[model samples]
Target: MSVVSPRQIAANLAELWSPRVIADVDDSYVKVARVEGTFGWHSHEHEDEMFLVLQGRLRIDMDSGAVELGEGELYVVPKGVRHNPSAAGECLVMLIERKSTLHTGDQVTDKTRSIADQLRPL
Candidate 1:
């Protein structure tokens, strides 16, 4: 397989919050997205979500606490924990989740993206 760059995928992102699948690792798909503002509060009831910052910063606010991540940092939101991810400015992030994981989880928002959309040509 050819090398895939998360940064390159992030750089080419055309829409905020719209993750594009960059690669597949077994049952998980690696994705990249550009983000800013608030992504709304949501939770994955059965799937843990992993977020890795590629550029800028990200803040994930959860009911228990909040975690701030700078570039190259990563955070995993356990399944069933409600959380909201926000950025004061533009940020690029890589996500690793099961193929069945849904964007926005228990809540559907304007920014919600579908698996078909994520799997499209990038």
Candidate 2:
């Protein structure tokens, strides 16, 4: 396999809240996406989701609390925990999630991207 840059992939993305798969690790997929504004409230009932900030800042809000992450930082949203991700400005993020994980979990909104859409080549 050839080495690839997830940051470059994220930088090239023209759409917001759309994630592109960069690689696969065992049962998980490595994804890159751009974020701005709100991504709605959603949860993966059977899997946890990890988010790493590649650029700018990100805020993850849950019923229990909220956390802000800057570049080079990461956070994991536990399974079944409803959370909403948002950013006041543009942010680049990498996500590691189960292969069966849905983009917006059980909540399907206009921003919800299908696995097929994420699997497309960058």
Candidate 3:
């Protein structure tokens, strides 16, 4: 085992909305991503997605309401609940989800990323 730095990893990301798998635990994958603007509305049919803010701010919008997260904060989007994520500026986030989880859940959009793409080494 080795130490991993989320901050350093996030700083090296060259693209937005692209997630890189950093590690795997049990049946889950640990990921880091850089994001800006807004992501398409979507939901995981069989998985709960955990989003932890490493930097900047994140706004998760659901039909019922919205939740804002800042650095060091986290929120878990329950399975089957439609949600959209947005950021006023650049944001770095860490994600934890099942290994089979899809980036865009049941909704496929221009920003959709396959597990193969997300598996790229950091």
- Per-model C-alpha lDDT, please? 0.95, 0.96, 0.93
lDDT of 3 at 49: 97
Q: Return the TM-score for candidate 2, rounded to 2 decimals.
A: 0.98
CA error at residue 113 for candidate 1, angstroms: 1.0
Collision count for each candidate, in order: 0, 0, 0
Candidate 1: the clashing residue pairs are: none
TM-score of every prediction relative to native: 0.98, 0.98, 0.97
Candidate with the greatest lDDT versus the true structure: 2
> Which residue runs does candidate 3 get wrong by more than 4 Å?
none
Give the local distance difference test score of model 1.
0.95
- Residue 22 alpha-carbon offset, candidate 2, angstroms: 0.5
Q: State the lDDT of candidate 2 residue by residue for 55-120, as single tens digits.
A: 999999999999999999999999999999999999999999999999999999999899999998
> Candidate 3 lDDT (Cα, whole model)?
0.93
lDDT for residue 17 in candidate 3, whole number 0-100: 90
C-alpha RMSD in Å of predicted model 3 compared with the true structure: 0.8
Residue-level error in angstroms, candidate 1, position 112 = 1.2
In candidate 2, clashing pairs total 0
